[model samples]
Target: MKKPIKKQKAVLIILLSNIFIAFLGIGLIIPVMPSFMNIMHLSGSTMGYLVAVFAVAQLLMSPFAGRWVDRYGRKKIIIFGLFLFGVSELIFGVGTNVSVLYISRILGGISAAFIMPGVTAYIADITSVQERAKAMGYISAAISTGFIIGPGIGGFIAEYGVRLPFFFAAAIAFLACFSSIFILKEPLTKEQLAEISAKTKQTNFISDFKRSLNPHYFIAFIIVFVLAFGLSAYETVFSLFSDHKFGFTPKDLAAIITISSIFGVVVQVFMFGKMVDILGEKKMIQLCLIIGAILSVASTVVSNFLGVLLVTCLIFLAFDLLRPALTTFLSKAGGKEQGFVAGMNSAYTSLGNIVGPAMGGILFDVNIHYPYLFAAVILLIGLGITVMWKEKQLAESFAE
Candidate 1:
């Protein structure tokens, strides 16, 4: 049964709030990282390893998290994840040694694995197919907004104490977690659960991955991986690129990112769904790939700050649009298997996150421009994949 409009709206607001807080927590630590490293006397390699560890943990946990979301229930997984996220932040804030920080990051990654798929599946449960694109846009917007604001807030609060931001993030997460337990009702009822249960027998990650290779889903899944890989590759070294090429400071990089992110949020809120409606999912995906590919190369040639900022905004806008569009398309195709498909999506994304930065770091060492060039090549490949995608196959897969 469909939820009434007002209740649905309220539920979506709460869900987006949790998502915002989660990403906020992730971003809050970014500004404090240098400080933390100084305190621990950690090397740059250790910092890189810290990032890899989180992605690795998230990647390994995502498939199981997705399955649990389907089997146990979305609310259960979300609440549990939030609690884990809170505890992880608290540990990180207080810990003095490297090993404790690693443990905290691993737990943080596991929490993310649980939270992301659960939220996507929950949104699928609440919104109709026609309503999903806009809902997904809102989800993406909340995430972008949280991440954009988090660093600014973190930088400001760091004057009080370097560890304070993590504690603050933990407090907010716990508040959200408790609020959810009391207020967020399970969207799936008995009939929905039975239907989902019938379709989804317990399966391992490998089996689920193989199953996702069906004609309809394979292209979308590939798109997800390619998009994430390309974006992460582009972004991982962006600060270094700016500083190397243009002598940009931390404030300059932050300003560029902030402007781009704010523009992205405005577009997602005001124009994203309408544009998706006008362009259709396949065309929208293709267009975004084209934009990303072109601007990535353009980034290498821009000499002036304004030119760089403009190109960066366009690149990020393409990426921001692509994410929710893919999610909406997948949600429409997923039908009763929303959790399964969402899990697979998260897994592929984690794979991209892991590999993209590793490769980007290596390429950055060899040539400053190589990462952007590589990203362009990868996105062009994604564009080629989209060109071969067929709408009929998507409809037929859902019919099955």
Candidate 2:
């Protein structure tokens, strides 16, 4: 007889695969989005709005999605999320109107609200404290791998037509849905269910919401927000920088991003866990932020394509280190209320996404280099906040 699958193994496979497919969809669009907007006759401001709208939708839905995941189960929510994502991708691929594109992004955001928090809580449910960092690293690796391949393929297809990439994205989302439905077994144990129920009985929705709003969590969220904002700005303006300043084609930008993703995947998969253990999450975060800030600053000064590529790689390497450390820390900090904490973390990221591109668009309009400089300053601010913050006090309070 075939042996039953181990719960940890099952959860890891499901989470990683789901994240891979979800990010693959996103990757497919990244290289094509700006040109697609230009084709649709969208103004710069309108394009910013279009990009920000997804984050807005995610922000609005995250709190509820978190609570629902806690109330229900992870597998059901994830499957539903995958379904929604598939539908949204199909809409984006087929729609001709800009308004339809906006609506599609909104729907995609809602799917993200479900997928991200659910996957995080699911990982928390299955992994032990000792194993959490490494497991989270694997998830990050999956995402980075998706980023590596998605844009390259999208850029190739986009050479023919912009809409083709969306159709390709839709196919990927559909594959994720099918995988979740068939391959992902439920991972929750009876003990976990009882624990969740007991916690739910003690806390109301307001209290749950308030838990993540505490000083320590809030500060961590802010750090994530600032970092994400900077990264988003870089993402929004990098293509323009490539085209205008370096005379690089879309394919060239795609190749650069692919290289960054390769570096990111390597760090997250092989180095992040050891770094967290050696330096600790807080110190690791500080180090990453410092390096990222310097890299962002350098990107502004570097005009040559090779120099820009090197700086970009450095920035993404720092980002790769930061992501798993912060996520593992946040998930642990949430303790028994992993769903709520994951939701709040996701909300902070969405807020960053909303703010970053919008700010980048405005800066791009003024001067191409301004966005990277602005991002460097924000990362410096985040570094200051991290240094002064007292983590132990916050952990004690949350423990209560």
Candidate 3:
């Protein structure tokens, strides 16, 4: 049964709030990391490992997490994930050792793996097909808003103590967790979920992945990977690239990134859905790929601060738009398999996140510009793949 409009809006607000808080917690730790490294006597390589491990854990868990979401229930998984997120942040705040921090990150990864698919699947269940794209856009915007605000708040709170931000993050996560237990509703019934689970019964993760390679989903999955890969490559090296190439200060880099994120959020909230409705996902994806490729290459050549800022913002904006466009497409096509498909989408994205930064870092070591150039090349390849893509079977369904 669908929720009443007023009740549905309230539920969506709570769901988006949880998502915002979760990502905000992630952002809250960014500014304090340097102090963390110094206090803990951690090396750069150790920091890299910490970041990589989170993605690794998320990648491994997501397929199973998806299955669990379908078999269990979205509200249950979301509540569990929020509790885990709270615990992870609290552990990270208090822990003194690298091993403890790694444990905390792993839990955080698992929490993310659970929460993302659950929330996405839940949203898919509540909204009619016409509402899905706009709803997905809000999801992306909440995330970007968290990231945009997180560092600033983290930096300010770090005035008291470096660990304070983590504690604050933990507090909010716990608050959200408790609030959700009281407020959130399960959107699907047992029989509905049982049906979904039956439709998606694969023996293992490998089989799940193999099923994703079916013609209906294969192209979209590839686009998800390329989007993650190209965007990760550009972003992971952005600060270093700007600093190295243009002698930009930390404040300068922060301003550029913050401004870009704000712009991306604006577009997501106001324009993304309209664009999707007007142009369709296929066209929007193709256009964003072209934008990503051109702007990525543009970033390498632009020397002035404004020129670089504009190019960088445009590049990120392309990425921000591209992500939801893909998700909206997947949601439309996924039908009863929403949870499973959302899980695989998260998995492919994690796979790209794992590889992209590592490769970008390696290429950055070779030449500062290599990462952007590599991103452009990868995006062009994605664009090529999308050019021949045609959506026939799903087009009629999507039209409704």
Candidate 4:
């Protein structure tokens, strides 16, 4: 019992650190990218592309990332992902032109596609169904915390220059990567890795995706997509929105993001396990989407900073609820295809990121209100799907 507890603690530390670093990299950039666009004299549409480009790379690479996790082992892919993440931030920190920024984002996207799936699969490999949701909640809390603090740090550092935050993000990523190489242990031995890798290589994303389309959790994947899509609209244009509407400073943007993440982190870490136990994943998801949609749409109408912050807090709380619940749902439903399913989960999320910002960007340009309105509509569609989907049947199939 002591041995197992010690082992769980060690693995939890490693997994949580990886997620923190990855999201820290992402969060550090958020408050600064709008300024970057201004520095380059880029349009909202262009900025949207820059933001979505990372997910586009993720969308393209996630399938391969999933297979790589199954093939090469989670440790190798995670380390490589971390290294690439550092490289991407470093490139962005030195970026002078739009082209350089785009290249950097592509690298960042590829890195995310690898890291997200690898870390998720590694967690799934170690934990049991009973404990998986609790584990994911902690991981989600780490991600939210990273994203929260990163922009606060980045915003303060941006007093020097916007690009400096990317450098800072890179430094943290490299440190995390070093830790991974030195201390992280692979749960699977060489023989298990070789066998699993061999078996996974036979199938591609198309087949694997089709295979994942059983009655149980296909809607869950769609929910992930819709949730991300709705959120990225706000994410892609947040700094711009605040700047245009209320003349927000970088610090202000950081404050908003930090506050939001704090709300998310508290729920994900402390309340998530019991909440899911009481509400179940499906009910939790449905309620969150409904309220979140209402909040997303409401955000468009707020003229004051306090109102905006209030709505953002609620919206973020909803997102925090969804992230871990969805992760736990997929993990429980996944069974043996830990790597494959985790990869697909990231793929679906990447797909949302792809569409959300791209569409959000274009819409934000048209009218400040359009993006939020569209997000509300997208989530409403998701809510309907959640309402109509055969939960009892899916649950039964998943158990089988």
Candidate 5:
């Protein structure tokens, strides 16, 4: 028997709401960073350190966050994470110095560690194997929409004050937390929930990680790491790069990110599902690698911000498509290990986030263009990996 449509719709809505709010909070700060740099008297290296610390916290917490999701319940974790996210933003909003800001970022990372893994595993739990990719794509689309709208809203509101976005983000997060508590419902049965929860408490993080490293997932893990590494590396220096290279203002940065993210949303919502159906995960991964490399290089050669925005749109579209496709492949291979696999997926992403910003900061100090140039070269490794790995066949259940 199929799950009821009302319940499916509720799950989808709650998940989408949760994801959109989380990403919007993150994006809400992007357009105001230049102002932040000036007000806080921050250097490129300082910015890099600020960005990296969050990842470090996430990296450390991701493994356990997964375990908690499996052992506890997804709705509990999601609500708690959103509440933490709200508190972190409030910390940023009220902080007087960089020291206080560091505390806020650490909190943000911890929140992400909880929120993302819970969201992914929840989607896997509720969705059928055949529909997982499309479902993931919808989640990605929600994220993209947040990314698209966030900067524009941030830029507009930022005219009042650089820190205004943080307060606004905090309020939005609080709203999400409130909504989640009231609206979200677990999809699992008492027996199923008890079985999953019962088994997880006995396992340690290291042991769970080892179990998660099933050979089938090794390449999936690497793909996430590489993609996050390249993207975060590029992102760390983005504000600095545009400011130095194009003399871009906060508004200019906001416009570019908004346009590109809108394009990303369109591709994920409309194109990603179809592409996954046609090209298959392997071929699609190959294509993202090739395009990602080209765009990383192409971004630097652009004559103006408009040119940069155009290339960025294509790059985001590639990333948005590839993420869901890869997740679909991993979810299919996960057997009953959805929470563990999702946790490892986040762990790898956090690793990339940790390394990418540090590398970007160091390279930016040496030369503003070096980060993007080097990222292009690094992404070629991804292209190579996709060729070397042959994924396991999709489950027979997915044949529908």
Candidate 6:
């Protein structure tokens, strides 16, 4: 048991670092992607499609990846996924055409689908119900740290060339891949391994797939879908808004993302654990949704650069508060089938990703502020769903 615990901690560290590196790769490209597209003379709709393609690919692949993680081991899948991510980044760095960019994003999405669910399941394997929220919060903090650094570094390098950010991202992903190979260990016991194998053998893939689509899991999936849709709207449009409306440079936009990420890290590290303990997952999620909705709406009205920056930070804080609670709730709802649940969550998030940028791009065409208004409405709807979920007691019972 002691050995298991030690291995669990080691796996958590590896997973955290893996998530950080992946986020770094994604974040590094985000601030510069539109500009890069502009340099290539791509249309706004085309850019939106490019972003949507990533989500679409992830959505298509996540269910299978999740099943594989449950049947196979998490460590092998994660390492392989990271290597693929590294290769995708390398391809993006070398390729100049829009077709190449789309292919690269598809590769990245597939890698992400595999990596994220596998890592989350690995965490679920090692952690108790009570410790799960805190663990997830730490993982979220790692992601926040990556977001804080990636944009800054990418923006600095992007001044040289658009491909530089991709190259840097490739380097980071390679580092993460190497780290996973050397430092990560499998966390499953022999019994658990046998059980997973037996289930895979006894149940057909279709049945196993259908079993993963539980209603409780679907409820969590809907919440993630709405949350991600709203967040992605903000993410896709924010830099463009800053540039068009406030005349902010790439560096300035990167700074805003960096500052927002700092706030996110602080909330995830210090406040999320305590919030989960005090308010419980359901109430915490409701509170976060309310706050996030209000702040997201407010972001539209804040015209000045400094004011927008401040509001953006608040929005990130609300997200930080929301994410850990939601993740814990989702994992709990998954119970023994953690990988399938994580995959469903990933698929829903990908669905949101598909919808968010497309909607934001449409609104961006209409008006710069329209996406935030729409996001506010969606988030309000999410709040209502959270209040009406009727599973508060269920969540409390599952808490560690």
lDDT of each: 0.90, 0.81, 0.90, 0.83, 0.82, 0.81
Each candidate structure's count of clashing pairs? 0, 0, 0, 0, 0, 2
Task: Give the residue spans of candidate 2 off by over 4 A.
Answer: 1-10, 31-45, 157-162, 189-191, 194-210, 394-400
Q: What is the C-alpha RMSD of each candidate to the true structure, in Å?
A: 1.3, 3.5, 1.5, 2.9, 2.9, 3.0
Alpha-carbon shift of residue 304 in model 6 (angstroms): 3.2
Evaluated at residue 305, the lDDT of candidate 2 is: 74
Worst lDDT window (10 residues) for model 5?
391-400
Each prediction's TM-score versus the true structure: 0.97, 0.89, 0.97, 0.88, 0.89, 0.89
| Model 3 lDDT, full chain set | 0.90
- Model 3, residue 52: C-alpha shift (Å): 0.4
| Residue range with the least summed lDDT across 10 consecutive positions in model 4 | 1-10
Q: Give one digit per residue, the lDDT tens place, for model 4 in 217-304.
A: 6888888889888888767787777888889887777677778778889888878989988998889888989998899878878888
Per-residue lDDT, model 1, residue 89, is 96
**Residue 319 in candidate 1 has what lDDT?**
96
Query: Over all chains combined, what TM-score does candidate 4 have?
Result: 0.88
lDDT of 6 by residue, 111-228 (tens): 9999998889888878877677888898789878887788777878999998889988888788888988888777776677668756654434465446645556655677889988
What lDDT is reached at residue 399 by model 4?
A: 88
Q: What stretches of model 1 exceed 4 Å from their correct place?
A: 1-7, 397-400
Per-residue alpha-carbon lDDT of model 5 for 1-400, expressed as tens digits? 4453345887688788888988888988987887898888989678768878888898888888887777777888888999999999999989889999999999999998889888888888877765677888988898888877787788889999888999999998999889888877775666776787776656476776676665567777888889889888987788889899889987788677777777788778777878888887788888988898899899889988668888888887787787887788777776565677777888899998888878888999999889999888878998887776744334331342
lDDT by residue for model 2 (1-400), tens: 2222244566578678898888888888877888887788888777767767888999888877777677677888888888888889889888789889899999999999999988888887777776778888988898888878887788899999988988888877778778778776666666775677666644354565577667757778888788789888888888887788879986788678878889888878777878888987789999989998898878878878789789889898898878888888888777777777787878888888888987998998999889989988999999998886686754663363
Candidate 4 deviant stretches above 4 angstroms: 1-7, 34-46, 95-98, 159-163, 198-203, 237-253, 300-303, 365-367, 397-400
User: lDDT per residue, candidate 1, 12-50, as tens digits?
Assistant: 888999999999999988999998999999999999999
- Give lDDT for model 2: 0.81
